[model samples]
Target: MVNMSTSQSNTSLSNGTAALYPAAVTQRSGGETWFEVGRSKTYTPTADDIGHVLKFECAPSPSPRRLISVSGIDVPGHLDLDGRISSGGTFTVLSYNILSDAYASSELYSYCPSWALSWTYRRQNLLREIVGYRADIVCLQEVQSDHFEEFFAPELDKHGYQALFKRKTAEDNVALIVVLEAKFGNHGIDNPGKRQLVCVLRSSDGNIWFTSVFNSAPHALLAMGKVDPLHPDLAIDPLGILRPAAKLTHQLPLVSAYSSFARVGVGLGLEQRRKMDPATNEPLFTNCTRDFIGTHDYIFYSADSLTVESLLELLDEDSLRKDTALPSPEWSSDHIALLAEFRCKPRTRR
Candidate 1:
């Protein structure tokens, strides 16, 4: 069974703005727990991103193919973000962990044919999966450093996104980067004001909110607190974020597999948006679990200024059934892609 994010009652601000938020949730026992990690790259999403979708899209394989830009399982024809973004806009962000090429070393990963794990095949496949979504902001984990600098950075740069990277340590692999489209302006539609720095943005009415788009695509298959003590890494996920102090904000539930963990976080603000369609509140699960299959990835956001809209549910996970674990007959990788849609609060008259 899949675990989707349940809708919560919309919260009202002191000014009577109707805002939406994921119900305040915490990890349950033996549940998804989080720690912190730093970025190889960081960026501030500008107003240019307002009218456009900010996707945290993952490359299908990181070997070949990439292009653009969405809605709840929406296509370019259906996702109308431009009109709304001019005043208040909606955009989708994704968090995906396309398994890396190093999986051949794992005994657990032997179920699949070895050739499939080749970076070239997986890279190209990952690119197809990512660009197919046309998301605005993309956060990916388990990305090898060399691949990110040589392929992802240059390739995505062609797609109009600015890239930042944060390598885990000086080891076999490098850090993951956060990518955002830089085609738009400095401030949200109206504020032509240049940002002093890319951390927070101030709307026309002086409502200051978060500046950076938060994402972590760690390398491990288990949550930080749930690491396997018996493992060589002392149960610690090599590509996982395990330090809270390193986290800018608390975020959603995450699981692991070949490319299991990835996420995006946002600050809260007040808005006057109407109630969201519960039917569209989708799950962010991209990886299958042991007993019950559910989301291993997520996007935790504050409804203070952004309105929740349709989330991306491209295909049925059950339908795309994997034979063994991940990287099986069903899907190329063990994890699925995760996406979220949000409408930035419209400029308010002062």
Candidate 2:
């Protein structure tokens, strides 16, 4: 565990408005947690007024403890943690690809028939829930244009979040990236390709780059020659396409494979059914598991930062583990959201 201690001098404002600063406490377990001392108010803060002070305390276990103090009033607020210090001198940053939108046909099936309606009514509520997590920066995937134009745009504005989206493609697809004004000043947008959107966030602590990506191809499934004797075309390679956008995110590129259980073989008959192998009754339903070592595979790469280690880790774990269990189809959209966290050091000046 790590810990930090911070201090600031009080200052006055010229507009006759004095700011009330809050001391913040941050912790990390499965996800990051943050606590603040005061509420939000409109006021101009002076150089002397300490808007926020953070203390980090590092403790490995229950016994002995050691503490470290990070100085500089211009530091970014997100890096301030009560314990566990990073040399980069920035706040904790988190990014996730939220698969919130469902297909129209799936919606009609009543699994989540009211998804769009409920999302419309509670869009602000959803944004509030995300903000409550206290993540300094966020990158959202699968944000439909209609959803943003009608709901998320105005709702996020209320919270002082500035958003920049990629230009709409011929497919009408776009990804949204948002940054809080309090911590970082907006630099601009970086368009790597049609499917990837990038932005640079500048703060006193450091300049952080964020990217959002969505792959265009569907996942394919492999079939053995004996299993599909009728049609050779019925068999798919199973190894899906990898997106370049994954490279920009500075983490392993994830390929979301949509599983299918539909059969493409000969139709079942009363007499022939008896001869069929019981195990072959539902070939499409069989779970898939694969392992790769020292080779570049279709779904992932061999690069240290770009390898899909987390996804492979999930597949390696036992299904009984609650954390590794696949989410029920009724609740989730077509694919599961994959996430990874990376720590970056502040760039030095010559």
Candidate 3:
């Protein structure tokens, strides 16, 4: 099913009169043939749509000041992976730094199209993408505090997710953590300290710990001599291999999920390799923008107790550069989301 969204809600339109606001679907192939598919905000393609390029147009009844039309090549339906995909004792986690509306200024993202950066359009796109992932746990950074309470929280709750937000006292941006209603039992989350958010899910399999991080160690080293000098506790070792002189320690045996992706023959597959950078064996860039393009987000898990099942396919730099940078018509934020599916390891009899 192809779902589309517009600033104006079409919920109140009558059946026969709904055609007044047509959502046209056309195919670009075969010498540009136009098909009278439907006029609703959603379209379900048939078998005939397999090899054709599909486009959608929604013209509102009263028509706005400008024409609102979107056209794109239609891709095939999702692969049938019920048997191949992991189930039971396994859950997916997604980490995304959805750029805050306050920071999405025209000056900062000049390369992005103006319409695509509008909060109205971006929020809908962001929500659609987030829900589409169907992740059990979601961590969002650069979230506007007000949007979390007014938009994301209420909307995600409808999908059975409970939200926990951490906002800086001096800033409007916040970090949001939402977990799906677990079948095993209720989940517990706590903010032990500032700038760090930790969520623990209690299940029959055991406890799964999930954390979202925006570490700037590398960038901080390049910019200055120290990392987050203002927040001493937040600093991490520039190179994760060595322990910092301060000896920041934790009891949890956590591991970097994607770093394991970098290990040769660990989780790398033909399709996964094609999406990663050859030099680093990691996704090309988590955050891509005009001035800078690099990885700035991560989803870490307790590796000792869990195993990686599969990861969300990453999009390469070329595809993201189509609009010069991110916040494009298709992608809503400057940073692409990171998702990893993990299953619990059987407990050993000690």
Candidate 4:
């Protein structure tokens, strides 16, 4: 029998050569496995390599079958093995708002007392449905700290995920945001009142960063509006407040900006009707659409091959349909979720 000890040290077992020894006589323990390399010096086994068969011998049991042969055993060391693919391609990400009952804290809203309990049950069910989507990265808005810890966090852990963000309360309104990472590291941004979480993923393929922002009441625009619009302190447009920092850090912006835009639009429509003559009201109202606020959710995505300008151009072209009617409450949330994707340049070989 060829000594296995010498083979391990050589690291150059000959091609088309099979080494065999008594299974019991092998030095490898039950949990240990063997690695084989071909004779070609140009080729070496790496985590990305795959397609090798592993055979095993089993002793005869007290049954009719003698000297049982293991039917199927495959080597599992390679990163590309077992149907695993390289992570160089573009992947989809989804951001969603888990509608926690607005009545939970008994705020100014006039919802039934039982609405909170019913909403919690529905939220759990909705979370389960969201988990089924199998997204690479998930950003959640409106998650309560205690609810996230006691319920959502545990559920997410079962599917290989991590949560970020601490609970904060202002008045009776609570805003929570969390990101679930699938094979990546989590990072955070220090926005004192507007707590945001950023995650960085560095794989052999490329680097991907995701940032989640959950704006509190009097959101980003309003916050910026509080400052003098013409003040030298604000050279950039109010909407551009977050842009500079994001561009400097090279982080993708995925914002879930929810506001009472729907209510605002209704109010605007009423004001327009009052200004029109009684007989011309119908035609004027039909033609006068409220442009006070647009859709809420916005996703900004990019890669090394893409620039901010190009990304914005694409967003303008494909982000929304001007002709499509807005979905009803049952079919949609008060806000929409924006999605963006871009191909990254391949990494250079060393």
**Which candidate gets the maximum TM-score versus the true structure?**
3
| lDDT against true structure, model 3 | 0.54
User: What lDDT is reached at residue 41 by model 2?
Assistant: 38
Clash pairs (backbone) in predicted model 3: none
Residue ranges of candidate 2 with Cα displaced over 4 Å: 1-87, 91-109, 113-117, 121-125, 171-341, 346-350
Separately for all candidates shown, the number of backbone clashes (residues 3 or more apart, or on different chains) is 53, 24, 0, 1
| Model 4 stretches astray by more than 4 angstroms | 1-87, 103-117, 169-293, 305-333, 339-343, 348-350
TM-score for every candidate vs. truth? 0.46, 0.31, 0.58, 0.35
Ranking the candidates on lDDT from highest down gives 3, 1, 4, 2
RMSD of each: 23.0, 20.1, 14.3, 23.4
Q: What is the lDDT of residue 322 in candidate 2?
A: 28
Stretches off by above 4 angstroms in model 3 are 1-39, 42-88, 170-247, 264-268, 277-281
Candidate 1 wrong stretches, greater than 4 Å = 1-86, 104-106, 170-284, 289-294, 314-317
Please give the range of 10 consecutive residues that has the lowest summed lDDT in model 1.
196-205
Instruction: For model 2, state the Cα shift of residue 212 in Å.
Output: 13
- lDDT of candidate 3 at residue 28, scale 0 to 100: 24
- Residue pairs that clash (backbone atoms under 3 angstroms), model 4: 47-79
TM-score of 2: 0.31
**Ranked candidates, highest TM-score first:** 3, 1, 4, 2
User: Model 1 Cα displacement at 95 (Å)?
Assistant: 0.9
lDDT of each: 0.41, 0.28, 0.54, 0.32
Worst 10 residues of 2 by lDDT: 201-210
